[model samples]
Target chain A: MKAFYRWTRDLHLWLGLFLSPFLVVYAVSTILINHNATPGRDAPEETSGPVLVVVPDEEDRIRLGRDIIAQLGITGELGGVRRMPAQQKIVIPVNVPGKRQVVTVDTTTSLATVATKSPGFLSGLVYLHFAPGQHLVGISGNWFWMRLWHWMADATVYVVLFLTASGVYLWTVLKAERKVGLICLGAGAVSFVVLVCGLLF
Target chain B: MARRGLTYWNRKLHIYLGLYFLLFLWLFAVSGLILNNTHWTFVKSKPVDVRSEEPVTTPAATDDFGMAQDVMRQLDISGEIHAVNRPRPKPPHDLFFSVVRAQYFTFVQVNFDEGVANVRVRKWGFWSGFARLHTVASMSTRGQNMFRDWWMTKVWSVCVDALAIGVLAMLCGGIYMWWQIKPKRRVGIVCLSLGCVSCALFVIGLRALFT
Candidate 1:
């Protein structure tokens, strides 16, 4: 029993120490999301002056959109392309963490305009929470960090689960703490059930 | 005496809150993983039970949310209302709102011309439902009047706030507890530093280059 307790304790501590920073990122993002912290005051910088790109002859909207951004000398995850066949124009959305660019292209004249918005670093961290999430699932994140951030996010969650389980075991080993811990555990269980059942039924 | 007592309670709260929040932490955390790993083939299951029901009687409510609820109650359906498509000016134009849940999702499209509500339900898998829990009251979900239309959404929102705050509190308590262990302090410092530096590099480093 002693050996097991010590092992669990060490596992919780060492893993918690490493995982806590990533957990902080999740926590901050959660707070930002729950509070609706997407402040609209900060305007986008459209000053990527005289954007010139070679309009490729590709017929596919996604490929054409990709080719335009490649020639324009900017990078991020490309979003859905809005095509205006009559006007021969396609609007593309590209995003990284701190910045999002809306690249509008004119196929006929090969003219392009880029409007870049820095949603702030805090916002960048918050954006990581829902990157190629459910909306655009089953696809790779278009940018490097967006893809890497999801990997980190996945690790944090798995650790949190392990830490929670180990925490309960460690608490159980302490006879004095058991009573209060049970009360807390019971209270949490009730809250979770009531809240979920309330939503579902 | 009070200061000392407060410190003691803080430790107790940390343990207890961590305990109380254990299941919630697990729920959100696991749900988070499900949502984050949508690239997995098994997780990419499509919505099942796709069928439209016969037209039902419509209701009269002034507000968008209230009207949605009236439509839901009349149809014997219940869930948070989302993806509201209000009376578009085009052919087959009608007011529509989705009744969203973990397993069952129903769409209510009110056709005033025929004076009926078209109910389309697409039952999703458990994975999709679980993932929906994490995003229940998130900014992604649409609401008006602070989710006043859905009592459950309001309740869920409060829980989300409490859980986030509780986690932060537990982290502080854990750090405090770590500080008291003289022997483990050095290694803990190294562990924490590596974690913090790595986090800063990804979050702050990427932004620095773009700026």
Candidate 2:
């Protein structure tokens, strides 16, 4: 019995350490994702400028795009350019609404017209919470590492659930405080069920 | 005379609640794993295909906007028109139309003038649905069954606040308990101090990041 208790304690503590960071991230992301409930007013910084961009031949649009993004100091990855025989579309992250801004450069005239993006505080936060890109290290998606962190977070929830349950059992073992413990447990159990059922139906 | 206060009750509840919920801990863990690894699980699994065909007639005069709306109405059958996709006077007519049918939503994209169309459906998965409830959304399955939100979320939030208070009580009580037991066991004091330091660091870190 003593050995079993010791094992459970060890499992709880070590598993918790592995899972804590994930839980924190998950919890924080959950809180931040619901933007309307928590209100904050911070104006977005905007800057727009025209730089000399090279117009590539019909065949080498890809190489030309890489060159332009590199020279223009644009952040994030450059997705493939859409090139029609007559017109070529350059897609980049412009400070704007809509996910990516498509720049249509006439095959005949190289003149580029810029459209502005609608700015908001929550949208940026939502982007960060969902895509955690634009960290200090430039534009990189969280990728496999981010998924691993999320997996750990998932694991941690189970540990917490276990900890909650075991703690309740321990409370039952404490005969003197059985009445109070049972009341709290009953309340918690009822609340958990109510919430689950309420949402499910 | 010293009277034990509400802090004591809080400590009692936290420990008890934490333990009682442990049985469901595995369920949470498993569900979370399934939720996160949706790429590999049934969470994202496509339902078995069931095909039922319905015949519908197209409108006589085909303006792009009218044709697109006609297609959407036919597809939705019962949904309300939420928004219309209007293209600027351009060659490729804008391809997107939005509609809501009950809890479900669909975005229809049509070829500007060609009328070639594609549709996307949006529906939340089970675990993702639950997570939405856990965070903050007025709509949830639980509400359907119990007609009440997770009273536990409100309860647990209060309980956690109380638990935080109870932790302080436990620190004090543990010290007293240690002092009483010190004659028999000498190392408890050192262990307690280390535990206290670790907890302090956790609080400081949480405050720095969250606040």
Candidate 3:
């Protein structure tokens, strides 16, 4: 019994020491998130940019589309390209969106122009979810790390559960147990059961 | 009189807040369980499809930037724009535009000439709640961050620190209770050790993975 108690004491102390920083972060973050309620409400707005086109001639838009298809390394199927000379526009179809880039080249001059979207917070969040690469800003949506934190938090929960269970165990079968201790055990058990059911179901 | 009164009030406030803190312990327990067995519980996710159309415009600072704006206008979506990178080694960088218009965020990539566009949206929910608690991102709020110059964020940080202390205290209390009533039987020790070992193994195994 004493050995078990010592083990619990050691386990509790060391784990607490190791997880202190995490606990503080978790607790405070919880309260903050709870109060704030909405992440997107405070999140920044989306940004936009212009489109530049480079082409040898207006008819060369198809060849330009093929070049882009090859350069972007489209693994998926490629669709045909259409040129709207009246609008000075070129549209290409592909399995994936934005797999094609239009380089509008001046027919008379060698001037060329390109255009793309402005990276925004929302986009960063998506990248973090799907393909988290070199982008540093997407850390917020990276659940792999967050999942690890939850794992620690889960361990702490088990410790608490053990404490509750042991408390009940010591109360019931152990000698010199008082009626008040038994009552506390019953109450704790009922309370814990209710909480578990409330949350799980 | 005022000094004594203030001290008394402080003690009372501590006791009151301590009780409130107990509520979090239960929350930690219940939420932790749900999070761990996410597979068993059904957490539904919905898909959002956005469509829009906008007239083509003139060239801007960079080819990527010009295309990105046109696409967002076409989709009838708005977001905050981040960096515009055109790496030499990689394909001509499309303008990467990010927008945090709601509880979620969207990323849009546009090629030059408004010819190609890729837009993705990310929404936050069940998992994010657990994550928000983990990072202490909001701990930097005004009052909380004060523990460190950034008081708001520090509020949760301080609470986490306190939880560690509380766990230590609870361990001591558990030990005191056990010592007061020693269990002689092997069964008791076995039961107790089983739970403790599982938890210990969980923590150690996790730490090992990261290290």
Q: Pick by TM-score: which candidate is best?
A: 1
Predicted candidate 1 versus true structure: per-residue lDDT over B48-139, tens digit per residue: 76666556554577766667777777777877676666444235646778777656778777876776776778877777776778887774
Tens digits of lDDT, candidate 2, B1-211: 1334544554454465454443234434455455345455454533232233333344453665466557756665333344455333233534455543323445666553454455666655565544333333312221212111234344433433343343334334434433443442344444444444443333233223222
Which digits, one per residue and each the tens of the lDDT, describe model 2 over residues A35-151?
223322333333344445667553554455555554554423333455555445454433211122334444445544433333333343333333322122222222333333334
Give residue B25's error in model 3 in angstroms: 2.1
Tell me the fnat of candidate 2.
0.14
All models, DockQ values? Answer: 0.62, 0.13, 0.05
Interface RMSD of each: 1.7, 9.4, 12.7
* DockQ, prediction 3: 0.05
Candidate 3 wrongly placed segments (more than 4 Å): A1-201, B1-18, B47-122, B126-131, B135-152, B183-188, B196-211
lDDT of each: 0.75, 0.43, 0.41
Q: Rank the candidates by TM-score, best first.
A: 1, 2, 3
TM-score of 1: 0.87
Report the Cα lDDT for residue B167, model 2. 35
